[model samples]
Target: STGTMSAEELMKRGKRHLSVALKEECVNKNHVNLNIVLDHLLSKNKEIDDAETLEWCKSIIAGDKTYKEFLEIVKSYNNSSICGLVWTAEYVAYRCRTCGLSPCMSLCMDCFKAADHDGHDFNMFKSQAGGACDCGDESVMDAKGFCPKHSKNKDRSKIEPPKDLLFVAEIMIPRLVVRLVQYLRHSGAEKQYISKMTSFISFLQELSETGDLMQQIFSNVFTSQNDYTTYMISKSDVGVEYDIYEASLKFDTINVNKYFPELADDLIHKTLLDEMFFWVIKSKFPEHLVTFLLSILPNEQYKLAFVEVFVEHYRCMMVELTHSEDKSSVSNSVVHISVQLLSPLKLAIEIVTKFHLIHIMFACLKHIINQARYGNTLNLTSNVMKEHCYWPIVTDFINILAHPPIVQYFLNSTSLVNAWADVISSLQGLNMNRREHDLHVEFETETYYKAFSAELEICSTPLWALLKHLNDSSSKQLTINIVNILVTYLNKWFTENSVGEIEMNPDEMSFHYPLHRYLSLLISNALQQQGMELTDLLPSLEFLEILYLHPLHLLVREFFFFFVFPFNFVVGTYKICYV
Candidate 1:
């Protein structure tokens, strides 16, 4: 009976069947035609039989939406305030057994309601910890499992990653792993290594029963449940256990540090470290991959090796940029990448201090400032400085130096102080440019001043630390340089606005207060020291008198009794003799 039916009649029957299967409101001709075409294309490509492909196609056709429209819907859903809320134990959450790729994947009530998982296997429970919603994470859940609110059809084949990253991840890392594996095969301890790996895996399995240790390991390995699902899917054929075993064998050897030695003199190790630095710079490696790479370092020696290589890489880049004739050709990405690599190593003071990272940073700052000072247009403050990433590099380095140990290193090193003074001198030269009426110039000037002000604020922490630790033994020149810079800042502020126009906010006034306090403390401490006289206070008193008349006077007066009393008493005696 089917064979006897006309072609047109068969088409009609197919459309009706599709409409019923898709649960359409009505049999619209356009919708039917679209579905037929999609089905034909999918079937011709032999993807119609694939469950996931079919599911995606069904969702697209049922919604009567274009790919772009579906993406827009997904974007809107992602932007929704309640969509990605992490539900805590206080709140009831839903988990779809059929759709969940892992136990960790759960949805908040709002996300659960918004998604279309009716008739599927699901459980509603009070979440134990904070559980992130996995509604739109296509890596973990099926497209068909997605609700109408969020549906995105991605063409994996069309995605193109950066070539450098691709080379590092796909080619470089794999090659290194293979070489390590080959080395392991030649070693006489293959049996022992395999046994140890087996024992380790069994231990992990035992730990998995307790949940906590296994969960932590999983969290370290996979940033999210979606990441776990994606990794499992991609490595399904090769198997994750074998990969882990291989990784363990590669790093388990006693001579592992030989391949990643502290110095970068060895060509192979140098290349590998350089590639790792590239990976860090690009920031293309996921967290799990970063953790895996870090795991290769069995001890502090190996970790220091990695840090040394990165620091050397940064140093070389800075040297080249500073020497370049056309400095503009050098990428500001060097600064950005350096910050990304070094900021995390802030706590690694032993390694950082040993390698003179702060010295390198100051050198880089001086170079950037010098370039800005002598660049074309002579005083193109923002464009030239921004082009070289002056502000970010300096600010980030200051943040890194905020650590106590590094600050101590900075204070102790005369070379670092000289480099800092060089930067300060360059800034002072740049500040000498005549003020321009152009809005752009005015805006840039304000930006530079604000950035400088913020840098001063951050510097106060280190300054105070130096004061407490060294007492009067701290570098007097460094203190004088800092005071001079503060004086310059005050002069600029006063020139910009009158004292009456200044805001009454203590927070606003706090910046000016620091200078007065630091100056007062320095003077007070000097007076307390032997051989210091009232005349030594004259210069400082004159400066303080200027500072005291500003709008910051109120806030300064508040803290005056606590920190500046010694200097205040001297000032009172000086005023009695003079005025």
Candidate 2:
């Protein structure tokens, strides 16, 4: 019987039957081996009973041909007739309206010319990127539009997908789920656990690369419309009326239970939480672990739990570092880890504000500053600061404030002015001890003077920017409060250190000049805003008068004049009595 059929016909038949066998529910559901499915299909089909054809089929089924090689072979045969060509943008392509099953079906010019379309509806257009010839793809083009070479086979009936394939899929998917569950349930060793997790991540990444395959599997096997409806109905029973559109918009909140209910178990949640905490503490791929956890547990409660853990850990570490007498023995690694953990939440404004993270950060700042202020001789040396973890921790908090939402929350709080004033006063108090020769030598040699100046600049610049940001708003009192803080610090600085002291140690001037410049800028900005007047700037002018009388550093005096002269001219010329 096979002797009468052409090789093309026989190959087509074999391909059709193979496609059917692969789609069989039993094969997919039962996870049947390809060889077994091929054997069964071959036994059922008498067409490939001949020894040579049998051997060819068996060779492919037995995995002698790699999947890629098999695919190449199939592609070679499929493209032999029609030009299986792709076109870039601006290239000419043809489409047969009569034969195209979809608008996407296209043909190369050569293939279009080779085919007969004397009475058929066809059109030519420039191709877009990724446009490919579909002349020989039966699913895309009807038989009537097929090129001469591809039209040899007249059969155009639909072939049902095999139940065996579905069976195999069902079986394999559940097993994979079980494997993932087991990985979470049983922790053998750290390396093994990380390896398992990494492998799973790799698998998911690879799966994602297969276009639409993951989506199809998720929709067809993992979840369905029926399941979504059932979940909504269940919610409705709890007095929440089911609104599909709203529910769809909030899919993340409901997806864990609807798409993968098994994963929604309390034990699984606890295990995930435990693993996340462990990884965070271990500092082992914690970011990746948190990313994975957040993807699965999109519930606000879950996020709140994570925030609680991170906040608790952060507080504990800050307290420990502040209190630890041997600063050298204390590790800032955990503190940095907590910062890394909480850093992602900065994007989540609601979570950050709702959890009062800004308040917590301020509390942490005060705790560390208080400890340094009263507990120990606050050192400005680079090595000492590093050992004390002072600059790093403070810088972390400041960097967090750099985020707009966090800063907005900070600005809105009642403690905003006092919190910043405390920090400024603390830095001033700490730097006072730096004036001793040995300490100054240590600071200058280690370049801590420049570093300290940079720290003050970093601190003041953001506050100045925030003041300008609030200049037009009704928060005029806020601006005045901040201005008062700056003026108070400037006054303290001028009265505490003499001009001779400043001249003796220019490095000390360098250490303190950033604050002065920032203060001048703040004052100049405050005068420009509505409802602000010369009277409001009296304290600042008084401090400048104190500066004018003293033989201050040339840069400092020039900065004060540059700031005050314009204000005196523009704001009704309030005469400053330089005492």
Best by lDDT: 2
Q: What is the lDDT for 527 in model 2? A: 74
- Best-fitting candidate, scored by TM-score: 2
lDDT of 1 by residue, 73-173 (tens): 33332222112333323468788878765334466677677777878899988743233455655544566666544456432233332222111112112
lDDT of all the models against the reference?
A: 0.42, 0.44
Looking at candidate 1, the ten consecutive residues that score lowest on lDDT are: 164-173
How close is each model in CA RMSD to the real structure? 21.2, 18.8
Q: List TM-score per model, in order.
A: 0.35, 0.42
Off by over 4 Å in 1: 1-271, 278-299, 316-349, 375-384, 391-396, 399-405, 429-579
Give the distance in Å from residue 411's predicted Cα in candidate 1 to where it truly belongs: 2.3
Tens digits of per-residue lDDT for model 2 on 1-579? 313333344345454354344344243343234434333433322332244443444333313233344334333322233333434346798888788755346787877887888888889887433245666655456767777755647353244433232233333332333233333323321445555355444333232222222223422322233433332224344232223222322211112222222322121213224333433333333333333333322223443455555543444445445444555333434433333333343333543565444444555655554444433224444333445445444545554554445656665554655556555555542343122322223223444553465355436645644654565636566666666766766676666665323443322333344445556666677677645676765674556656554433444434433343443342232233221
Q: Give me the runs in candidate 2 sitting further than 4 Å from their true place.
A: 1-197, 200-271, 274-278, 284-348, 367-377, 381-384, 387-408, 429-443, 447-450, 453-458, 471-474, 484-510, 513-519, 529-531, 537-579
